[model samples]
Target: MRLLITGGAGFIGANFVHSSVRVHPEDSLTVLDAMTYAGSRESLAAVENDIRLVQGDITDAELANKLVAESDAVVHFAAETHVDNALADPEPFLRANVIGTFTVLEAVRAHGVRLHHVSTDEVYGDLELGNARRFTESTPYNPSSPYSSTKAASDMLVRAWVRSYGVRATISNCSNNYGPYQHVEKFIPRQITNVLTGRRPKLYGSGTNVRDWIHVDDHNSAVRRILADGQIGRTYLIGAEEERDNLSVMRAILRLMDRDPDDFDHVADRAGHDLRYAIDPSALYDELGWAPKHTDFEDGLRATIDWYRDNETWWGPLKDATEAKYEGRGQ
Candidate 1:
């Protein structure tokens, strides 16, 4: 099959490309990436020969239509994903996440191509810290940040397109993803790179906020399954059932890096920060027989740390600028 993957140079999308190339040799891919600050060409270096990379925006209607017209399927992954950036300036997120998704949907509808929309669990907002409830497919939309709100809007667009235009599309709202090639600005990579650079990990507020963590490989695997067998107009929640608080994650990273667990600083928490986010992937498992391979968070974190350690040349150049951005915000 020929696939067009938007934001293919970014973390999760790059991992998806790598996985597809390795597992499905018969498939061909064309990656459309804006090459924003978070999206790096180096992330796709290993699979460069296997896939065609197009430096473009997903919001470009003509480009999206042309690409979708020629592809068997489209995986929409392009977005301004950082919550901090969204809080500071939401215009980019609005353009990339909402307008970009509209463009892709229109193209897919016009071309009659299958599409898989990648989204986040944050769109469901936060649950009570100790609540037994997890985000299910029926969870109501309650986005707290501009980033998540835009994603929510995009998801709605996909649904409306499916019902109104009969567009073949599936949506997957996944938990936090951590693996190699992730930008240093993200939570896990920021802490990991901080320890590597001889800086203490920074926690926000009291570090009680929790997040459901999933490995990027597992997330991509589920996405592939959805693309292959998932029902159109359906939504799946992809998670590993591994829930951990911010402080615990920080301490674990420090311990894995052979540092003191308490060697961290408490910075101001993010505005409108959700208390917790947990995903119930029972439907994904019972319906599609999908399960996460990396269930052990520590093992995954260790592997992720090793990747960052061994590939300093890849993440080193971005560390300084990333830290500076955070420092400037007093975060």
Candidate 2:
């Protein structure tokens, strides 16, 4: 099958590219990305020759139509994904998440191609303490932050296209993903890099914010399975069923690095911080036989720490920029 993956150079996108090329060598995988700072080309360095990559923004309808016209499926993974960045400025978020998704939906409709959209559980917003409302395929969205609000909007647009235009589409909303090649700005990488370099790990609020953590590799597998066998017009939530508070995750990282727990720097919480988010992947597991296969959080943390330490050059630039930004250099 011929596949077109937008934002294939970004963290999870790049991982999917590699996963596709290796697992489905007979399939054609072409990537379209604008090469934004968060979308690093180096992530695809190893598989550069195995797949076709087009550097362009998904907002360009002409380009989107052209790419979708040639592919049997389009996995839309490109978006402005940083929460803080979205809080600071939302225009780019609209252009990337909302406008880009609209353009992608239109292009796929024009081409009569199937679309698989990648989304986050954050769109469901904060979970009340001890309350069990794991996001299901039918959960109502209540986005709290700018980033999630835009994603929720994009999700609505995808659903509209699927229902109104008869466009075949499958959407997957995943939990927090952490593994290799993730941009350093994310929670896992930021904490890992910070503690490894003998710096304090920053904890937002009391760090009690809960997240369902999943290994990126496991996530990639779930997406591939969904693309291969998932029913159309369905939204699947792929979760590892491992929920941990933000502080617990941080301490796991510190322990993995053999660092002191006091290295965690307690910081003031950001506006509209979600208290928790948990997802139940029962639908995906029961229908598609998709269940996560990864080490426990501790094991995964150790392996991830080793990766960041060994691949310094790969993550070095991003780590340096993150430090510089903290020092008030780049704006």
Candidate 3:
């Protein structure tokens, strides 16, 4: 299959590209990325010789149509994903998440190409700290942040296209992902990098907020399954059932790096921060027989720490810039 993956140079997308190239030798891939700050060529360096990289925006109608016209399937992963950045400036999120998705949907519709839309669990808002309820495919949309709201809008556009225009499309809403190649601005990497650089990890508020963590490779595996055999117009929730609070995650990272568990600072909490996000991926597991290989959070974190420690060349250039951005925000 010839696959066109948008945002293929970004964290999750690049991981997907690597997984595809390594696991599916018969498939060919063309990655369409805008080369934004979060998206880097280095992320795809390992698979650069194996896949085609197109430095273009998803909002470009002509480019999107041209790429989709020639591909067997489209995996839409491009977006303005940082919630903190969205809180400060939402215009980019709207343009990249909403309009970008519309452009992809139109191209897929015109060419009759199958599409898999990658989304986040934040679209369903947050669950209470102690609530037993987990987000399912049937959860109602209640996005709190600009980033999530735009993603929710994009998800709706895909559904609209599928129902109103009969576009072959599937959507997957996944939880927080951590693994190698993730940007340092995110929570896990930020803490890991901080410890590596001899700085204390920083937590927000009381660090009580919880998230369902999934390994990036596991997420990519589920995406592949959905792209190959999922029902059109259906939504799948992808998670590994590894739920941990922010403080716990910080302690685990510190322990892995041989730092004190309490060796961290508490910054101001994010505005409109969601309390918890847990995904119920039973439908994906039961119907598609998809199961996560990285169910142990600490084991995954140790592997991720090892990767960052061993591959400073890959993440070093962007570390100072990412930390500078966060420092300016007082986070």
Candidate 4:
């Protein structure tokens, strides 16, 4: 199979590319990335020689169409995904998430190629902190921030194209992903990097916000499973069933790094912050016989810490800028 992966230099997409190379050596892979601030070629360093890397914008319909025409499947992952960034300026999110998705949808629809649209569970908005209900495939979207709203729009576009144009597509809305190659701005990497750099971790508000965490590898594995056996016009939710509140995760990181659990500062939380997000991935588990290998949150988090500890060169350059941005916001 020939695969064209958009945003393959970014976190989850890069991990997906690396895993695909190892698991399916026969498939030819091509990556299209814009090399945005959040994306780096260094993330794809390990598999650089194995896959063709094309630096381009996904919103370019001509580029998207040319690549889609020559591929068996396209995994659309390009987007402006940072919530903080999106909240500050929504124009980029609108252009990339909405227009980029439309470009890819048109290309795939024209070429009659299969597509897998990766999305986040934030589109379902927040459930009350103690609520037992989790987001499922049928959950109605209630996006709270510009980031999630754009993603929600992209997901809807994929669904509409599937029904309206008979486009072959599948969508998977995943929970929070934490593993290597993740940007430092994300919660897990930010705190982990802070401790590694001799800084105290920062917690937002009361730190009660909960997120269903899943290892990056586990998330990608489920994506591959969906591509192989998932039905068309279907949306699958992917999660590891490892839900942890912000305070608990912060304390765990500090404890693992030999710091006092309560040694962190409390920063003002962002506006419209969701209280909780949980995903029910029963459809992926029952229908596709898929499960996450990293069921232990602390263990996976430990491995993630080790990755940052050992790969300072990979994240060191961006640390100061990232911290400065947060510090400027008084967060």
Give one digit per residue, the lDDT tens place, for model 3 in 1-331: 9999999999999999999999998998999999999999999988899999999989999999999999999999999999999999999999999999999999999999999999999999999999899999999999999999999999999999999999999999999999988988899999999988887788999999999999999999999999998999999999999899999999999989988899999998999999999999999999999999997788999999999999899888988888888789897
Model 1 scores what on Cα lDDT?
0.95
Candidate 3: RMSD to truth: 0.7
lDDT of 4 by residue, 146-224 (tens): 9999999999999999999999999999999999999999999999999988888899999999999999999999999
Off by over 4 Å in 3: none
Question: TM-scores across all candidates?
Answer: 0.99, 0.96, 0.99, 0.99
Clashing residue pairs in candidate 2 (N, C-alpha, C atoms within 3 angstroms): none
Q: How far does residue 308 in candidate 4 sit from its true spot (Å)?
A: 0.3
- Please give, for residues 204-225, the per-residue lDDT of candidate 2 as tens digits: 8888789899999899899999
Q: Please report, in order, the local distance difference test score of every candidate based on alpha carbons.
A: 0.95, 0.89, 0.95, 0.95
Candidate 1 regions off by >4 Å? Answer: none
C-alpha-based local distance difference test score of model 4: 0.95
Question: How well does model 3 score by local distance difference test?
Answer: 0.95
Model 4 misplacement above 4 A: none
